[model samples]
Target: MVSRTTEARTPPPPSLWHHRAFRLFWAADSVSQFGTYIGNTILPLVAATTLAATPFEMGLLSAAETAGYLLIGLPAGVWVSRVRQRRLMRHANTVRALLLCTVPVAWWYGLLTAPQMIVVALLCSVCAVLFDVAYQSHLPVLVGRDQLLEGNARLQSSQSLAQITGPGAGGTLVQLAGPAYPVLGTALGYLTAALLLRRIRDPDPPAPADSPRVPLLTEIREGLRYTARTRTLRAITACTATANFFNGVLSAVQVLFLTSTLALTDAAVGAVLGVLGMGGLVGAVCAHRVVRRLGQARAVWLVPLATFPSLLLVPLAGRGVLLAPALAGLFITGFGTVVYNVAQVSYRQVICPEAMLARVNATVRFLGFGALTLGALLGGGLGELVGIRPTLWIAAAGTSLAALWVVGSPLRGMRDFGCRAGGADRPWS
Candidate 1:
């Protein structure tokens, strides 16, 4: 492993709020995030309600949402690296908006089916993969590396806010207009985001003309190799992948648990899910303060370690007094997840060479989200065989174990990233 001990004491740049391109990027992303959360709630509800999908079918639908990350994540990174990221992201948003439009149209014509919804979800996942890779790769260039934590936290806060309002809005729309029409707002979110992206005045830095082009497989291998060799990165990857796999299991059955098991109405379900976003918003707002108090390395592992235990309360949820535990559990999960993400993602962006950032990120997502795909299938099967409650317990336990990957790794010995043996520690790079 190549471990650097240098302190980053570089002077801070102007605040990102003053940067025009970044402001546009942030605004566009905020609009897109609102739509994404709405789709996240309504799509599965469509399968469960209108189509009467089985638990296993729900698994298939959920897996389809992330299948593109497993299938095209690595290759998408290479493509993202070669393109103008702003334009690429715009195209991805447009495609997602168009694909989502098909769902409501099919419903209007009374042609909507579980199969069609799954197909649309799968196609949107492909666009999501492209957009995510481009966005992550483009952030450093847009705001400079020093501002990653601030930028990510802001973006995460927006997403958290959407989570609160989006699900509530979706459930209300479903009650008023049926499940189909609520998707109109979801599609409009993406379309509006794409339009807003056109106003960005700054351009990506031009790639070096003299740089030799490598074969696709060669580039993929290079990225994989780098992630494998970095012990810290490898540990983080393992932690995130394990958590996502189990999270997939939870996602597969969570709605079923709420609606079928608890007998909650669609609007009530949306409100419960919205609570998850509320926790995330608090976490995002507090992430910087936590990092300053706990150090980045500690924040990454310790927060999850402290908070994940709440997940055990989810399976215990019942109709009356028991629901409070589940709410607490979901809130804590969201808070810990966002805090851990802000810390680790910024850490990786700081350490990885800029040339390899996209590839390394792709590799991480391929492994992490690929596991999520498999876990969703497993969760559905388990829910059918054993039951929803048992499956949830299993998922909660498995997710908690994920913190061990980082706790036992080299991160335990360091106070802050690159500060174990260095002089005055760097401000976030």
Candidate 2:
């Protein structure tokens, strides 16, 4: 039998997009993604502006949405292992679509209340968590190992394109048709996603009957242990988690900083953010080339370093030419984030075992998303105490620190995802 290292070195099969099933899935995901972006922009504005929610109340809404990631991530992973991934994704999107519709319905009936909106947000968030975990787990099987990075780049590019138009369109729709109606659009998007998911052919074979079924706790521990044992995975996880923590903090304060500190209108803020989407699109398109030239290890290091230039503009918030600097900074930040994500995700997908994909994904997300929640809390409280500019400065400092996670790790030297010497047969080929 061929050694794992030899197998790893061999090229994987051709791309999955040539298959009709994957093409449909891709189309559906692209269309629905636009809708998700619309909802993302409209939801918080509805809570704060329409409901007259306090900062603390708004923070609670954010927390409620993210908290599900912490609560259900591990369990969802374990549960996903026993079911068909495509079916679970279809159901998840369906439920999300249905639940999102309730927001507009509540408003139509004059029954919209803060507590009810919070509940809707929480439920919708839970569905999002489920769909994301299932979707990520399914990708490796759908596309072979060699094309994983390209596949992800295509997905990210779609999302970035959606972001370019989604927010401004969402804002206009909300202004014209009201906040509740935008959610209807989001609901329809989910329906489209579900329809697309249905057309994708299942790629993973059925689990072995003789495969051991471990205890839930043991299964979770095994997933974590596997991640810990892998040098590349450990570095990727650390880098992603740290980056997310700081990025979350910045996200929490961005709108407030733009509007209050920089003296920009809401429209201006939205326009600037919409423009930043282009940077993400550029990064996604260039990621493959960057990885090819720099190698995976160097790409990870380089992406985060791109973010540092943006942080320098934080202190220039109130200067005469502030708008130009701020817009430029956000664009660069968006670019860095997408590049970093592509490197980290592609590496994770290649190294992880097929069986543990969902569990490992859930575990990583649980920790990273939990950090996001904490970061938001920290940003909000710090912003209140020291003002938005200072809060932003601190958040930037934290984000800069994320680069350290991989600087000295073994991941810094990794050239690719091939198996180690003397290991089992390479799975990618």
Candidate 3:
């Protein structure tokens, strides 16, 4: 009954489900994440249970998994910009799958060793560095900037879901069969993800033929300066880096604490971790609502402040009823951390220049993950010297303090972030 002009006004926004390319990307990313989570759980269990590794070896193994992020992160960003993101991601996954395949193969032949596992982890880390940079950079091209929040939210929710199911499945498999089966499953997952990625019909456009070439170091330095000059990015990076450092410490000792201190079985450990990961699922689902209620800027700093202090309970966990404290602490920490990640990642993506996005992301990750590697080593050494509980206490207390970086920074005063390329702080809407 209405006129055409009147009816056409203010049409509804397009849904991501209707976007075929995004659907493909989501499927690939989800599959890859699910496998990665399984690997994360099973690899550590292999080192601890199958190999009977010491505390320092556990820490060393943990550090190896993330070492590539610190070692090759910066250069990977520049490389990602030069290639077709989809192809790169596919290749990276394929390489990772092959590397992971070696683990179970060696184990079957009765040739598996701790050093070989560490080597596989290290090589996979390099591939992960490349794949991650390509993945994050490819999103804007696959879906428009307007759909970023929804796209990111959906992706994060899937990742959280994987965090819950992956560990449980891996642990259950390890208990029922052995570590080799889960390791094989992880390899298959990566191969499947690679195949899915190859099916993306709409791939990233080729670079311009006339685009000016620059030296690699020059490009790297430019990204560094850009991030350093941006007040919001700098503050966010500092907080994230600090948190990762302590998180590394926590991760290095978490399994040890659960298996040794509490004397939980492998299956029980996975179940506990899976239960704790439910918090991330809840947080990812509620992230948009939280941002709407609290404003994005407030959500970033305020959520961490509210939830991170709960980690103090982790060191207090023991047998029987005492385990409740650790469970509560991990759940609360996961919730806050996921919410903060969704908000901050969307903000950075919105504001960064399209050409510079990969570099900026890499720069942030380099610092954050570098700290993680150091923290892992520290956690291992401290667990041996002082004790597991004391290390946990130190890690928890340090993580709680990380929020202070943003609390006093310029971001505290802003409601949301502006979309300008260089450090401009204004309300987005």
TM-score of each: 0.94, 0.89, 0.95
Supply every candidate's count of residue pairs whose N, Cα or C atoms clash at under 3 angstroms: 0, 1, 0
- Tens digits of per-residue lDDT, candidate 1, 348-428, equal 788888889889888888888888988998999999999999999999999989999988877777768867533222222
**What residue runs in model 3 are displaced by over 4 Å at the alpha carbon?**
1-12, 419-429
Give the range where candidate 1 is weakest over 10 consecutive residues by summed lDDT. Answer: 420-429
Q: Alpha-carbon error at 299 in model 2, in Å?
A: 0.7
The residue-by-residue lDDT of candidate 2 on 357-407, one tens digit each, is 888888888777777777777666776677767777887778778777776
lDDT for each of the candidates?
0.86, 0.72, 0.86
- Is candidate 2 or 3 superior in TM-score? 3
User: Per TM-score, what order, best first?
Assistant: 3, 1, 2
Off by over 4 Å in 2: 1-17, 202-209, 262-266, 312-315, 318-321, 419-429
